[model samples]
Target: MASSMLNGAEGLKLTGMRSPHGLGSMNSTLHGKPLSKMGLTPFNLRKDAKFVAPKCSLSSSRPASQPRFIQHKKEAFWFYRFLSIVYDHVINPGHWTEDMRDEALKPADLYSPRLKVVDVGGGTGFTTLGIVKHVDPKNVTIIDQSPHQLAKARQKEPLKECTIMEGDAEDLPFPTDSFDRYISAGSIEYWPEPQRGIREAYRVLRQGGVACVIGPVYPTFWLSRFFADMWMLFPKEEEYIEWFKNAGFKDVQLKRIGPKWYRGVRRHGLIMGCSVTGVKRQPGDSPLQLGPKAEDVERPVNPFSFLLRFVLGSIAATYFVLVPIYMWIKDQITPKGMPI
Candidate 1:
């Protein structure tokens, strides 16, 4: 029964693609309502909803020059346990505001209301909310490794119909050619293997589909670079484009983004600096080859070391939190049009 239902959904998707008006005008209704309202499932997992191991070996090598405390999956899982509580309120206002979110998502081309979209590492559904503004909530899926963050997303009234699941970004469970659009925002810095995650993004997207990844660019200022290195992976802009190109994406483009108060100053590097978009021209897995899983999740962690790293990483993170406030104050006092 599940298989038949799945087949039916695929038929709808294919039919929607042929329509002139896109998926929105397709006859995907059941009893005068969308199929999702009647529990018509969309996800077609590779291993019966279990983690599907990547085809290529995941390299454990660190992409950034220095090691970051929260780059590991286990550490990040714990970090968001506390941050999720005040994430939308505290982080959103300073770093990822509604305006910035909207502007960054523009290149992803969320044009069809019935387009199937996946928000990988969708923590707290902040970016997913931006997606739902253009597409139907039922057509969206939010996946993140952090249960605490997913809990916040589940509580959002606007996201009631969206499918929310706990999943890894580096090893997505979905089959290839699964989604029309893929988006990940402010989540790449936490990835231990960012290239693997970006590869997964390319794998899941259907031919002609778009993948938009929004993440922090490495800081140039000496002080900001110190804290950024300690806190998490702040990749240089060129790395983002290279990752997409290696994954077999075509026409890859990146748009620079930052807080309004920052006044175009990239010396310190905004928490969310660029939005990179790429089109999937093929119909299978990413072309980028990798080797062996980086960090072993099953490896036992020492209690003392974990405590020390977590504490120091939290302190480094505090510096970034205060940076926006400091810049905002400067922007207010530095005259109307001048940069802060």
Candidate 2:
């Protein structure tokens, strides 16, 4: 019966002994091991039998020169070192507000208190505070590459039970399929390789689990675009969807969110613009393979270059900080139901 299912299937030709039950049954095996043992569930087999990978519409190629001043690991590390002092107080109020954090995490589907969750690039416990609202504090783990940022997260009383550690987003330290939900907020912009970090998100999630990434979107206005380019990664909406599909996630979805003052005016772009969620259908590492790491952490850095990038990056970052305040002032004068 298992053989009958593949009778007319194209490209896939089953060879070797077969069980009486269909491939959907647990009796099926490929090379002496049960298909179930190999992470090949009935859903995967049925999908693979006729699945043709879709061609990505967007180009994966990057620019020759580094566009953003703070996109690299080293630059971001030092950038956060000082920013961590006022991140929760200043940055959160203007950009990553409590309201925005709650809305962004909703698609992550943190429904169960028993769910094991890993908040990747979770800085200062701002987003983790939202995760703890749905899941138990002990069940959540917050990982970031910035030690200074993690130190601030440790100070939060509500997140005391949550595990806080310093780790890379592009290369997570956790084992594959170790988490029920993978979440990252306001962090992808700093990643030199956004796709690699997204792949890790897929790799760490259990089968049937969800991975939600919330980050900034590119601005349309000319002035905002210039500042956004110099600041950090501001990926377009299509780029986010393409990255998730390439990572072998099924049921991919994206939800747009921003501050109330914005009034859906996305021409300027918000710091935390969209929430993208995808579910892992089958387990193990992501299918998309890449050559090497974009940024080498062990490599020596030049003192002069480091200081230059840090200064310019901080200057660009200040523009984003002021954008929300400017918008808020406009929102106040504008009528309640009108766009600011």
lDDT of 1 by residue, 1-340 (tens): 0111111123211110221112122134423754343222222222222212122111232355345998887888899999999999888888898878986887788998999999999999999999999999999999999999999999989999999999999899999999999999988998888888889999999998989999887775668877887889888655776688788887665556677777656566577877878888889988888887687788999988888888889898889888888888987889865644
lDDT of candidate model 2 versus the reference: 0.75
Summarize candidate 2's per-residue lDDT along 45-124 as a digit string, tens digits: 34233323223322232331354889888999889999999999888887778877876776677888999999999989
Q: Could you tell me the lDDT of residue 137 within candidate 1?
A: 99
In the predicted model 2, the residue pairs found to clash are none
TM-score: model 2 vs. ground truth: 0.81
Q: All candidates: CA RMSD in angstroms?
A: 14.3, 12.8
Off by over 4 Å in 1: 1-66
